[model samples]
Every structure is written in C-alpha cells, then in structure tokens.
Target: MGNAGRNAVVLVVTKVADATADLVIEQLNARRIPIVRLDPGDFPTSVAVNAYLGNHGLSGSLRTPSRIADLRGIRSVYWRRPSPYSVADDMRPQDAHWCADQARYGLGGLLGALPDAHYVNHPWRNRDAEHKPAQLAVAARCGLDVPPTLVTNDAERARWFARECGPVVYKPVRNTDYHGDDSRALTVWVEEVAPSEIDTEVGRTAHLFQQRVDKVADIRLTAVGDQLFAVRIDGAPGLDWRRDYDALSYTLIETPPEVAKAVRAYLDAFGLVFGAFDFGLDRHGRWWMYECNPNGQWAWFPDPITERITAALADRLQSPGNAHAR
Candidate 1:
C-alpha cells in the first residue's frame, strides 16, 4: 500500500481460483500497487456494489472482504473470466431464473461501465471478437492468409465444401460447456473430416470446416498493449496443441513482420488492447490465421516468456494512459 493514497487503484475482475490473474496480481503486489480483486458472481453473498448516477455520472463503491474499490478512482480494470451469477437452489426455479437475469444486467452493466478506467479488453469488445466467422473475415481483410472455410447447417453444402477444400478439419466455432451422460465434462477436439463421414447429423447445427494446412508447427502469439510475444509450439501429435500439454515444446520466436502488422490491424479492427492469436505454420513457412482469442490464457507458457507477459500486463494496468480506449 506504499503511495496507495496517491495512486489510483486497479480492479481485477475474475474468479477466486484463476492462476493467470494470480500472476498479474503478484506482479502488481510487488510494485506496491493497490488492487481490489473480486468476482462479480459473488454478489449478494460475498461481494457488494453500490452505484448511483448523479451530476458527474455513475459512481459507487464495490466492497469485498478486505478491500473497497471506488468506481471513479479506479485507473484500470482487468476483465477476466468471472463465474456466473447464482442464487440459492432452494428458491423456485422460475424465481431463481429471474433473479439471475436481473443480477446479470444489473451488476454486469455496472462493471462494464467503470467511467474512463482502461480495460485490458473491454467485455463488449471481447464478445464481438469471439465469433470465429468475424475473426477469419477480419484477419483476411488485414492481409493475413486464411484457409478456405465454410460454415453450414446444410449436409450437402458441408460435403461439397469438404470435397472442394481437399483436406479439411472440423472444430467447434466456440467452446461451450458440455457434459456427458454421466455428467462429466467433455471436449470436442479438432479432427480431420472426410466428406463421406459427414451426414445429415451435420445439418442439426452450424458446423465449421476449414482447409487443413500442411503445418509443421503452431505459433501462439500473445499481444499485450503494443508488445507481442511469439512462441513456436512443436511436438503436438494432434491437430489441436491444446489437447496435450505435456507432449508439447515451446520456443520463443520473433514474429514475422507481415504477420505482426496484420495482427495489429486485426486488434484495431476489433478495438482490443490485448489478444492471443493462434496461427498455423505451413511447410512453406507461411503463417495461416486460425483464430484470435480476446480473453485467452497466456500464463501457462514456460519461464521467461510468461514472466515477460505478466510484467507487460502489470505495466499496462499501472499506467492506464498507455492503453488505447475505443
């Protein structure tokens, strides 16, 4: 709390057990910067927010166990993943549903409108950038190479596109919570799809099919403010490197000039200050755009790289003026 009386506070919005947020918080703590970390989902239970609109605008105080954050005095906000708002299960289902919606729009709206506080990535922008179709379109427009892709709910169209694209892969446009019959969590991994394998079941919902690149490796480039950290991930024996963490190797690498420029443009197009971009490095040394995760995780990488990213984020949170606001 050194000089905290003179310094503006940073509000970290995330769940209690977030390792990524923990890293940044540790860095800020070492700097003696004041931070109020709270999950909005804890409202009415462990957290409280009081806001009022007056002559100046919306201003209030958010109270947690050990700290209280002044809405107007917050210099920056690190909006990470927060748990969903919940109420007691003993209440009627209909009443609980209504209460949850109210809390979402009420407390959620207040957090989204923190009056001049810099957001690592504003939640609204994150929502807009999360769509895979929009991401591919923007990346291509920014001069980045994009594979031939098709999103369809028609069985014939899917098969036709798959045949035309030669080697195609099927992946979920966005990962959503899914559970098996036993109530265990399930993941839909990216896999090669043959035209014949696709059937009327594909028509049940929209599916994304992309021309699979003859990739030799994968690149995960994390951007913080104006800084970019590119890491080459090798030895992943499957289409998605995320499927196996222990089998992968990481090497810090320099970003290609063209790819770097296009990435910056893509970020600007979506008004995002931070993004984690995934690219496929083909045998020809070409980088193909996969997707850009606005609120993606980055703290899992090896030593020096993770340290650098954490420091950059801490720096951005400390100096809100250095971040661009849409």
Candidate 2:
C-alpha cells in the first residue's frame, strides 16, 4: 500500500452492536490502519460533523466519542446498518420528526459527499437496490434465471396471477417492522399460497408472488467487490431457509461460470460493490435468483466462511478504489 492507502482512514458507519463490523475492524487494526466508526443516529448528541466546500472540493472532519476522522483523508466507507437519526424525547412530536429529518439530510448528506472515500455500497445505491421489483428485472436482464414474479395491489389481479402461477409463494416486497396484537414482533415468511387464499385484504398494500422453485438446496453467495464466496445451504425445513437457520448446514461450493458472470453484471447494473445474494438450487442443478441484500449480514455463517468474507471486506476497505462503477 502507498502512503495514501497506508495513512488513509476507513470510516465505518454502523451501530455499536455489529459483530461483523467488529471483525473487519480487527483486521484493519492488526494492519495498523486508521479507522473511525460512528453511527449517524448519534448526531447532535455523541457524534458531530464539520464540513467545508472550497476550491478543492468538500472537506471536513467527523468526531465520534473515540476518534476524529478527516473527511479528505478517508479512503473507504463501510456503510453498514446504522441506527435511524433521532432527537431529544422532550421535544414535541412534530418538532422531533422535523429535527430527525434535518439530521438525516444534514449529517447523512455530508457522509455521502466525502470527497475521496469509496463506499462499499453507497447508502443511495443500497436504497435503490433494495427494491425486489427492480432486482428481479435486473437479474433477468443480466442473464440470471429469475422466477416468474408479480407485484400488485389489486386483489383480482393477484388472484388471477396466483391461478396462472399455481404453487406460488407470497413474499413481502420488503421486510419492515411488523408487530402482532400483543405488540410482539412478527415475520411474514415465504409460504405456498393457494389461489383461494387470496382476498381483498391483499388490496391494502402491494405483495410479491412468485412461482416457488422446486429446489434441493439454497445458496447464500456473498460478494465483496470482485471476490465471491458461495456456500450451499442444506436441510432448510421449509420454503424459506431463514425460518430455521439452526437446522441448516453449509458446504463451500463453486459458482458456475455463467451464474458468476451474471452476478457481476447484476452488481454492475446496480452500481453495487457488495451484495449478499440468495438463490435456490433446483433438482436439475440450476440456480434461481431470489434477491440480493446490498448490506446483508455474513458473520452469522460458520467461522471459516465468515473469516474469508471478513478478509475480503478488509481487503476492499484497505485499498482505494471507486466502488460505485456507474
């Protein structure tokens, strides 16, 4: 590494409880790299940003509790899951909402404007890539095998689509906070939907329905820059492997050249440098694209795979290069 990389700071934007971030930070620390970790949610409280625009460009400093980082000298930004911006609870509800919005745009904008730092997956890009509709369309365009999918809020249309694509599964367009009557968290797992189960309640919001893949296994392929680590997940109890993670076993697997090519193309299309892709392996050994989580978790995997992923991330973060290809 040259002086620029050797001396540059890696800004980690994430929550304090992230174990994945901690792993990468350990690697950087061992290499004696400079790192500044902060959560935007702490803005106006524990975190602060001071930026200036001049002839050169935007320059500033971010001060967190443990460290201060020079924006101009930042080499890379690991945009992990950061907490939402918040304000003092004593403020009126309206005032608090407005304050939070300002904090989001103000401090959030500054982080996005860092002059030289490369973001693993820029927040804006992550937001855009999070849409399942766009992801399916792009996956098909990139030569990946995407299941027949439909996104609609019309009850009749949803019923018709289910009839046509019988044995379909209902999936949430996006996973958001949902609670039951008891105020307990709830999850809408992917489940086989019979056409008769469709009703007017579906009209309340949009839903995603896809022909369920007859798969023998699932794959969680985590890509960091050009490096892809694929693992075959076996023994999932149902349609969604996530429902029973404890029952799953993993085996390191090689990605088919065609699938690998399409994955890179898909990432390029989204301008994403990192993505955790989910795929279903059919009985015939074909991979069906499910979705890609731009900022997905990886530390939950077994140690060997997790260590490899951590090293790949550290390699990308330590080097200076534009992750945003578009």
Candidate 3:
C-alpha cells in the first residue's frame, strides 16, 4: 500500500514478519526509506500482464494511498530473496503452475513499472542469466580458466567422463526450489563420483558432471556496478562450504585485474547490476568459475560487504537524475 503523500518503498517478501530480508528492511527504514511489504501468497490469484503502479501512489494494498496522503515515490527496488509457496499443498499441478508463473512474471512487471525506480537486478534479465554452462563459456571468453565439464543424461557418457577424469563432481544443472532443511541440496561442490556408480540407465534424466579440481580455497565475489570485491574463504573442509558456515574463516582479498574484469563482463552479460559469484580456487590458486547468483544472499557476510552493497544501492536509487518516466 502506498501512503498518499509519503514516499513508500514496497518490498515483496514471504514471511515478511521473519527472515533475514527483514534485517535489510530495517536498514532501509533506518535510512528513512518508507517501505510496504507484500507477501505474494496474499496477492490475488491472478493479475494483469502489465504493471499498475501510478505516480499518484500505490493502490489496492493493506493501506490506502489517498487516505495515507502519499504519492507514488519508491526510488529503488532490491529483488532480494522471494518467499516460497506451494500450489501442490492444495491446487493441481497445471493450476499451480499458472498461478505461480503469473505471480512471478506479473509481480516483477509491476515492480519494473515503478516510475524511475532502480532495480538491483531485473527479473526478466535474470531468467536466462545464470546457467552454469553459459557462465563457463563466458568465463572462457573473458580469459578465466574454466575446469573441464560434461553435462549429459547418458550413463555410458557420464561413466566415461568419470573414468577418464578419475575424481569428478555431479550436481544439478540449475538452482533447486528446496531450502531450509534442504540446504544440503544447494551444494555444487566437488566430490569423487566413481565410474562404476554410473547406471547405464542414467538416460532417464539429465545430470551435470565435472572434473574435480583440488581447491586450496574458495572465493565469493560480490560485484556492485564497477566495484568488485572478493573474500577468500580459507580452511573450509568438505565439498560444500555452505554446510559448515560456522567454521569457515574469511579474509578480504584482491582479485586479479583480469579476473575482476571478467567478473564485470559476466554480470554485464546478464544485464545485472549486482551478483554474488562462487569460485573454487585451485591448488595453484587458479580460479574456476562455478556460478553467479543474481539474487544471492550476502547480509550474513562481513561488514564491508554490507556497506559496499547498501551504499551502492542507495546511491543508484536516490540519484536525482534516474527518475522514472511517466
């Protein structure tokens, strides 16, 4: 809901009452940015294909724009993590598909409709933005060393790659919709996959296989505009660092000039102004591109991370010259 006269920023997040996004919301408020949160689950089952916000202010919300005496005034938008919902919990697959699809594409369009409001990362662009294979290609084009990779559904081919490479890793082709208790599911870390385990029957579904690189460290590159910052995560054991966040140690590190240049190109390739990229630094310290998450979480990271992102976003959103055109 827009306050008729107040400059309100709307944030669409699930479980708005809890979660880390709430902390970001608090920070926004501390900066005196008026915010209104909407849970997608609470929205109408269907919506128009076009965006609906007006310069006059937001309407049809928990608060009334006219009564609140507010004008349409959201200066920027941060597409943080979106909340989750299940149509299977109640509706049929087809019905659920339509509902979720419309909400995602539609709600995103509405936010994009905001006059002159800057988006941290646009959704339409994010759709095809981060495929692992595509990222690898981009990394190579930018002169970054990309590890040998194989994506297949054939058991024989997968096994052959494993046997040829000895120690290899297997993971999903894209991000899965499972989290919370399933944090383990987010791992794309390297592990030895024996060739014997390959079911000549793997033709059932497509799986990703990659040659494992012995890593001496990991790096998380957070890019905001032209500003590139990387943190070297040292001494993290196990294939997935996310599995043991508590034990991981971090040190601010400078990326190679070429690597930094490549990171910017990778984000620009996706039309993204922000991203959190994961890389496996080989035993020789050569960086191997894993994936770039357009909406990856970083609030839990170090203070410099928070300061860089928050300041960059604020500058873009509050710029007097970036106003939306009617």
Candidate 4:
C-alpha cells in the first residue's frame, strides 16, 4: 500500500456538525480505525481535496493546493452526512452558493475519481439513483412486484387516476428536507383521493402517485454487495411503519434466494455498495418493491444488522490488498 493508503488509512466523510453524526463518529472511531470527519464548509474556495490525516485522525494538516495530495491512500470512504454545503447567513446567498456548489461538486468528484481508494457509495452513482421511476424499472427487471405508479402534473389527470385507485400514496420524488430540530424525514402519506382534492401545486412539481397496497407487513432490506439483511415491520392505521418503530415488531427474516438475488442485482445496477430498501409484504406474502436509498441510514437497526453492514464495509476496504473495485 502507498503512504496515503497505508499509515493514514480509512477516511469517513460525514456531516460532522450534527449531533447524530457526532455520535456515529464516536462509534466508528471506537472501532479502532483512523477516521476523518469533514464538513463541507471546511474546504477552501477553488480548492482541491487534500485531506491530510496524522495520528490524531482528522485534526491533521489539510493542504489543498493541487488537491491530489489530500486524496492519497484512501482505502475506503463512507458517505455519511449532514450535507456540508448547507446555506448559511454569513455569506451572501449567491456568493455562498457559488463557493458551496464548487466545493461540494469538486470534492465529491475528486475523491470519487480516485484511482485506488473505494468510496462506500460514489456520489455520482447516487445521482439519479433515487428517481422513483428508475428504481421501479430496475426492480421490475429483477422480477420484483411494484404497484402501478404515475408521475403527472395535470390536476385533472391526477385526480382521475387517484379516484380510480382510491387509496393511493404520495411520496417525495427525491429526498425531502426537514427544517425542525431533531427532525424525522419520512413523509409517506396515504389518503383516499377524490377528483376535487387535486390542486394546481401538483402541476408545479411532478406528482408521483402509487396505489396503496394492503400491506400485511413491511420489510426493510439492507444490502452490502452480495450480503443481504431483512427485517419485517408491521404497520397499523394512522402511523406509517417508519414512525411507528416503537409499536411495530421486528424479526430477522431469511430473505428468499430470489429476493436476495434481486436486491443484489438492483444495487449493482445502480453502482452502489450499500443501500437501505423498503418492501411492502402483501396479504398473499408477495413482496412489492418500494425504493432503495443509495446512501441510506442503517445505524438505528438491530445489532446483527449493524454488524453485517460494518463488517461488509470493513471487508471491502481491507480486502487482502484488493484495489478499489465496484
């Protein structure tokens, strides 16, 4: 291994400003691995990413000119966040945006393009990975069940379709932002639609609608390469399975061979090494695919799930002098 890849080993790029991310940093650091936590603002204007790591982890000198020096010896990276390029008050909106965008795009591109270091989930690959239509198409190709969905802007057209489907679902097309402190971001809402309910706002942004399946239970699938883990969750009236974690039940379910294969294929198709996926288990015990987050959160899951994920990541990074592979 080269000096960058050897003495100063694994680097984890995370939103270091958040408490949740801080807690995660403690855990990863406790694992006895050298970790570097970087906030997006830490980068210089018109900078290259030179993340210098010494004995003290991230506090080491970061020299950014030429930028290539900072990207050295990175065996692997975990794209954990709070996004670094958050809009702030000190700088003018336009000025801040120009710098933040440059740093965000440039840094991600530099590290992602590293000839040897492996990124846990490449940022470029994560792009277009969350489009519901794309996810649906990939799932279908894997032979998984998906509810009929429509992406429409015409209120009349959406109303007509919702009326036909009755209890359809409304989900954010991509990721949603939460402003409140200690926020919860899952906003999956189910409502029985009537034609009168449609509004002009639906046209402003494309409406993504799906038929609400009569879910017997829900499944959370976490995938790391070919390794797969699944947990069953029960959803009742009023609360979605995500928010009702307290009342819900969880069981380690052995994923069917085909289900595992499909999930693996879906990840590979998107060029992702880790994903958190959702599945609706119907009364017939059939699985309906929902979505897969290319850089999803999984720390809240049970120990076995956590163990499998952390081990898979560590294995890939330290794989017997293995060069960074897909």
Top lDDT hit: 1
lDDT of each: 0.90, 0.90, 0.66, 0.67
Q: lDDT-based ranking, best first?
A: 1, 2, 4, 3
TM-score of decoy 2: 0.96
TM-score of 3: 0.78
Weakest ten-residue segment in model 3 by summed lDDT = 62-71
On a 0 to 1 TM-score scale, where does candidate 4 land against the true structure?
0.81
TM-scores for candidates 1 onward, in order: 0.96, 0.96, 0.78, 0.81
> What's the lDDT for candidate 1?
0.90
Tens-place lDDT per residue, model 4, 116-197, is 5676777777776877789999989977788888888888888887888857777767657645566756454544455677
What's the distance in Å from true for residue 226, model 2? 0.9
Model 4 lDDT, full chain set: 0.67
lDDT of 3 by residue, 160-233 (tens): 99988868988778866555684654435445689988886678777888887788888998777777778888
lDDT tens digits by residue: candidate 1, 195-225 = 9999999888889999999999999999987
Error of 4 at 285 (Å): 1.4
Query: Candidate 2: which stretches are off by over 4 Å?
Result: 1-5, 322-326
Please list all clashing residue pairs in model 3, or write none if there are none: 3-70, 4-69, 4-70, 4-71, 5-69, 5-70, 6-70, 115-324, 116-323, 116-324
RMSD of each: 2.0, 1.9, 5.2, 5.6
